[model samples]
Target: MAFLIRKDFPLRGFATCGDCGSNLRSSWSKGKTKYYPYYLCQSKGCDSYGKSIPRDKIEGAFADVVKTLEPSPNTWCGLKPCSDVHGMRDWLKPKILRV
Candidate 1:
């Protein structure tokens, strides 16, 4: 029997490598009493390819990207509620609820 370990990080599939254009992967390093998260690019032959990026740094940068994405009212008006999910299950819920 074989088992696989999977690490699910927030930016796992969302971020791409700046050098080789590969998707970034994330993992945790075990410390004396705790675990630390890090993101890395797995592409071969790229500089800084396998180097780990500290979780706080990567996550902070992602947060900054999110901060700059406030949609204008016109942009909001073009979106419709998702038909696949029930009430309050769409991405626009928070903005809708505020009004």
Candidate 2:
């Protein structure tokens, strides 16, 4: 029996190569505990290695981007309630958000 190897970032996910003009390939390195994931250029003769950017840093940046677009209480109140799935369902029932 043969198994297929799947990659996280596919061909469409590649942005661009730093050194070469080709597309960059993403891979992960096996660490002692977890895998160290990164993206690298597939072009030959390129001296550039995988960027050192981590997953958490990217997530934080994305959160900051979302925070910038957040609406104030006054502006948010004017919007109509969405569908049942999207709207608050019995927010008055109980509150135990914090530990």
Q: Score every model by TM-score.
A: 0.66, 0.39
Model 1 lowest lDDT segment of ten: 90-99
lDDT of 2 by residue, 1-99 (tens): 122224453221323454665544556778899898655666567766544444344335445654666567897777666554223323311221110
What are the lDDT scores of the predictions, listed in order?
0.63, 0.46
Off by over 4 Å in 1: 1-8, 82-99
Per-residue error (Å), model 1, residue 31: 1.7
Task: Tell me how far the alpha carbon of residue 2 in candidate 2 is from the true structure, in angstroms, after superposition.
Answer: 23
Per-candidate count of clashing residue pairs (backbone under 3 Å): 0, 0
Model 2, residue 95: what's the lDDT?
24
CA displacement after TM-score superposition, residue 59 of candidate 2 (Å): 8.1
What local lDDT does model 2 show for residue 50? 45
Query: Residue pairs in steric clash, candidate 2?
Result: none
